[model samples]
Target: MGVIYLVRHGQAPMHAYSTDPVPADAPGLTDLGVEQARRTGLELARQVPAFTAAVSGGLARQVATCAGVLAAFGEVHDGPLPEHVVDPGWDEYLIPALPGGPTPDMYRSPAAYQQVLDAALLRWTAGAADSDETYAEYQERTSAAVDRAVELAGSGQTVLAVSSAGTITALIARLWGVPAQAWPTLARAMVNASYTKLLVGRRGITVVSMNEHAHLSAADVGLATFR
Candidate 1:
């Protein structure tokens, strides 16, 4: 038997300008985001002795969170941590790609971008967003990530993966056999840096915890946003 920990990345920069697309390879975390990751790492260290492997999405925030977690585990060598892997499929649900129009530089304003993002998130969660990836495709990708984590955990190992709240919530919805349209209600309660534990064995994968945040103080939990 093995355990897999699905961890959502910590708080991120909520600047109104955040709607601007970051270079695919260079997204960075904000100061508060770093603190969130550090606190999450401390919590994980208290709960689990060591992870057999740590994985994350290719996103900068995911990798940054992994770094914080490794440092907390006292494995801060100057090189790569052991068994770190990245998969694009583990990335957050893509915001609907904007079509040909004014470049980002020509957008209405920061506040306007934030409003658009808020509405888009709502439509996405409500299953009303016409996405490049169909709803079925979205579910399949998330399921594959969970299945891959289970497969990688072979035996007597614990795997930890850092991703986004949306990714984690999508997986949870599948695990609970909930309808996709219910994701908004499902995701609304998720806390950043919180983790859910799943046990995989011969019978099947079992959910041990969902959105566990016992390691964090109340102040360190919940969403942080810039309005």
Candidate 2:
């Protein structure tokens, strides 16, 4: 049997939804985000010392988180690490700049920003986003990426993939047979640097866990983060 781990990337500025200066699409991990990734790596090294493959979405935050996890894992385990693969297919769905949407003042309030983001996501999933990729296309891209990872893990090996909350939760929601409209609930619940586990064998891929973040809290209670 083989296993696959889906890790959500650590937090980025995501200034698109706020007044921060960073560009949402190009920002990297925050300092706390780096720590979260390191802790997640240590936990993975303890749980599974050997990995068959390590992958990340091509985004800056995802790539950084993957490197951090592998670096931490390498510190404790005296084994050769797998070369990291960059897969754009696993990238998060685009968050378009909403026109005539929330004002800059609205971005100042976390509650207001969340409300707008959630509503915008709902519309995006319904094929209303201004972006070129539809929800169906996004799903197809992520699903294909997952298939590639599972194939890489083939038989008694484990694969680790670092991705964004939106991409990870979308895949999980589909596997759980949940409607796409409810995807935001799962995405919102995902913690930064959290991992979801899947078992692959004769019975096919089965979700063993979702959003496992005890490692973060174990390291530091304040490290538990959803944004």
Candidate 3:
């Protein structure tokens, strides 16, 4: 059996919504985010010192987080570490633009924006909203990305993949036979820099653990964040 570690990238600055069409570059991890990734690496090194493969979503945050983990791991372990590769398939699903865009007031309140986002996601996953990348298409892409990790971790090896909360939740929900409608419940709870372990064996993929964040809390409770 092989183990697949799905690590959610650390916190990134939330994108502010506006009527202006100027495209913003995808945000990278914050200072706290960087530290969280380092702490996660410290714990991973102690538990599993080596990985057969390390993959990351093409997003800047995911790439940075993957590097942070590997760098911190190298600090403690003198052994070889897997080369990191970019896999756009593991990227977070593109959130559809809200109708008329969000108002200035909505942007001011994180809670308000979250409420709007939650509704939009619910509609998207339920097939009630139109998007360039349908929810089903997202599932296919993420599954393929995970299969790549499984392939790399063949036999007794272990693989690590850095991704976003939504991507990780989507895979876990599917593996656990949870319906798409309930994805928000799991997605909302994903802590930054946390990892979920999946076992790939003869029977098939099975979720061994979900959202392990003890490493963050052990270092500092404040490091555990969800966004």
Please tell me which predicted candidate would have the highest lDDT against the true structure: 2
**Segments in model 1 whose C-alpha atoms lie over 4 Å from true places:** 15-27, 75-81, 96-130, 219-227
Clashes of each: 0, 0, 0
Task: In model 1, state the lDDT of residue 144.
Answer: 85
Instruction: Select the stronger candidate by TM-score from 1 and 2.
Output: 2
lDDT for each residue of candidate 2 in 127-187, tens digit (9 for 90 to 100):
7756668777888899999999889879999999999998998988888898888998888
Q: How do the predictions measure up, each by TM-score?
A: 0.77, 0.89, 0.89
Off-target runs (Cα >4 Å) in candidate 3 are 15-27, 96-108, 219-221
Task: Evaluate all candidate structures by whole-model CA lDDT and list the values in order.
Answer: 0.68, 0.84, 0.82
The alpha-carbon deviation from the true structure for residue 45 of candidate 3, after best TM-score superposition, in angstroms, is 0.5
Q: Kindly give the stretch of ten consecutive residues in candidate 3 with the minimal lDDT sum.
A: 14-23
Ranking 1 against 3 by TM-score, winner:
3
**How displaced is residue 225 in candidate 1, in Å?**
7.8
